[model samples]
Target: MPHARTAPALSLPIQDARERLRVLIRDLAVVRGRVVLSSGAEADHYVDLRRITLHHEAAPLVGRVMLDLLQREGLVPGIEAVGGLTLGADPVATSILHASAADPALASLNAFVVRKANKAHGLQRRIEGPEVAGRRVVAVEDTSTTGGSVLTACEALSQAGADIAAVAVIVHRADASRAAVEAAGHRYLAAYDISELEI
Candidate 1:
């Protein structure tokens, strides 16, 4: 028989965890240089948050910080699941799921993945993991530029009968992204903005 895995202990206080995550993101994820963004726009720097989101140390911190953010913003109570479009949001959603396991109040929180397209075979499901029907969910992403990706996830979630509580991200790169999400009628929450990253 296989042994049951345990949730990792929440070691740092939320404030400490958030600060540590900020430093890690600043040091590891911010790439300073001319680059084209996913929206095909040119920028002087790029925030490739996957570097920290998928990191061993930083990933846990991400969970802690993000969970705290949701709690502080009062978005956690009825949020049954967290996720966004696949790829960028994959590790972020998983991190939140793992972190929630360490907290009694949030242990019921689940994670889901929004596939770019429905699986051709099997159940032909567009959203993977636990069922999200009729449950309130928060969409998560590592970074948002135009909010297109997260919005896409929200659309699929709505189609599947899930109520979108809000959209959250580790970094908010453009003000336009926030506007776009709000224009779509969902609250936008970001743990850090580019100014805080000092890039």
Candidate 2:
């Protein structure tokens, strides 16, 4: 009889995963030029986090780092699920759940996505995926400038009966985001802050 293959390790060293993400963000995501942000503010530098979060190699790294932040920090006890706003946050939420499959120590987390607006037809839902009602959820975003996007999702998820436990972002470009999220009563965490990306 053939021997069963062992499952690979689900979690990496938190610092190593964070370092990998830091390098990936600096190399592949930073774009130097004037660009309009999601908040409609013009900025000289734009960090295109999707470039990293959506990449084949970096996406997994992003998920690992973020899960480490949430799981290891004891920030949101009993967080049963994770989610974020559509488009920017889709990958982060998905990746973390995917990565969790390998780690027996972590609870399997469900992923939900909040739409920019409610769909006009079908279920006509503002939020999609597993029912988040009463679920402790950690919301993530790709890049946060003014915290508007995460706030939008949080409000919707909250209304849907989800306990918005905490918020995480792959790239935090300004203190405004941290302040805004914290003010809303959710501890804000980041894989890489703006100052860390200044290279």
Candidate 3:
């Protein structure tokens, strides 16, 4: 008979995972050049976090680091799901969901997606994957400059009867984002900032 194969452990110490993710972001994601942002602001450089968020190695680290951030901040307990706007937040939310699966304590965590707009036909829903109604969920993003994307998701979530636990991100590039999220009455958390990436 063939022997059964065992998978390797998926969890890591929070600090180690966080440090590794920081290095990966600096090396793989940060692009140095003048460019206009979605927020309509020009900057000397841009941090394109999707590169790391979807990377094989960095994706696991993203899950661990983001989960740890929410855990330490005391937002994970009552939270039933995690997600934000589609595209950017999809992988981030999925990463966290996968990471949570490795830990029984976080096993209840699930993921959802907020569409840019409600589908015109069929279900006509804006939020997808596991109903968020009446549940507490954390909004996630790869990165944010003005907090607009996460906030948009939060609005949809609110309309769906979900309680916004907080907003979390992989990288926080601007102070304005923090202010914007807080102004909208949601706690803001980030695993890393641009300065921590040594950029």
Candidate 4:
């Protein structure tokens, strides 16, 4: 008779990711409130992703979370770079960059950013920092209500001949933004969504 095959032992309970995300949000104080989105419309809730992403403790956590997500999907494709829109994407991109620094497989991931508008002088480059042409990149942002900034950055990166692998957000507003990303055919990963983080 053939030997029976058994599944590998698990280390934790199900819904572990969701529960951890909720606790992190609550601990970081990501909350709901009236605010304007990148699309210039009033919103019932706002996720000040900086409240978490900028924290000394939160930064590493964000990195681990993103790395875990990619790992779970069995997607370990290396990124030639990581970046997004200027202000909102700053911290999240930095977190990815810092995390990559500690991992030998990801240490080559360069950091870059897109300007809201061209400088009109000097280099006049929309993309600043390491060259991104012909590279696979991961874009990150703080919050997305309409997904304008993320799209804009993607467009610029594409125009520069880049392959956008995925996008990561600190908090997903769970509105039209998700649809926008799906429409563009890129995987979207969020640390927390509005309903999940609401008080």
Per lDDT, the best of the predicted structures is 1
Native-vs-model 2 lDDT?
0.83
Deviating ranges (above 4 Å) for candidate 3: 1-11
The predicted structure with the larger TM-score, 1 or 4, is: 1
- Compute each candidate's TM-score over C-alphas: 0.94, 0.90, 0.93, 0.79
lDDT of 3 by residue, 1-199 (tens): 9755322226455776677778889999999999999999999999988899888788888888898899899987779999999999999999999988888866569999999999999999999999999999999999999999999999999999999999999988899999999999999999987898777
Instruction: Summing lDDT over every window of 10 consecutive residues in candidate 1, give the lowest-scoring window.
Output: 2-11
For every model shown, the clashing-pair count is 0, 0, 0, 0
- Where does model 4 exceed 4 Å of error? 1-22, 105-107
The better candidate by TM-score, 3 or 4, is 3
**Backbone clashes, candidate 4:** 0
Answer with 1 or 3, whichever has the higher TM-score: 1
Which prediction has more favorable TM-score, 1 or 2? Answer: 1
Q: Which ten contiguous residues of candidate 3 have the minimum total lDDT?
A: 3-12
Q: Pick the candidate with the highest TM-score.
A: 1
For model 4, which pairs clash? none
RMSD of each: 4.9, 5.2, 4.4, 9.2
Which segments of model 1 are wrong by more than 4 Å?
1-9
lDDT of 1 by residue, 1-199 (tens): 9755434327776777778789889999999899999899999889999999888788988888898899999987668999989999999999998888878866468999999999999999999999999998999999989999999999999999999999999998899999999999999999998889987
* lDDT-based ranking: 1, 3, 2, 4
Ranking by TM-score: 1, 3, 2, 4
TM-score of model 4 (CA atoms): 0.79
Question: Model 2 Cα displacement at 58 (Å)?
Answer: 0.4
- State how far residue 162 of model 1 sits from its true place (Å): 0.3
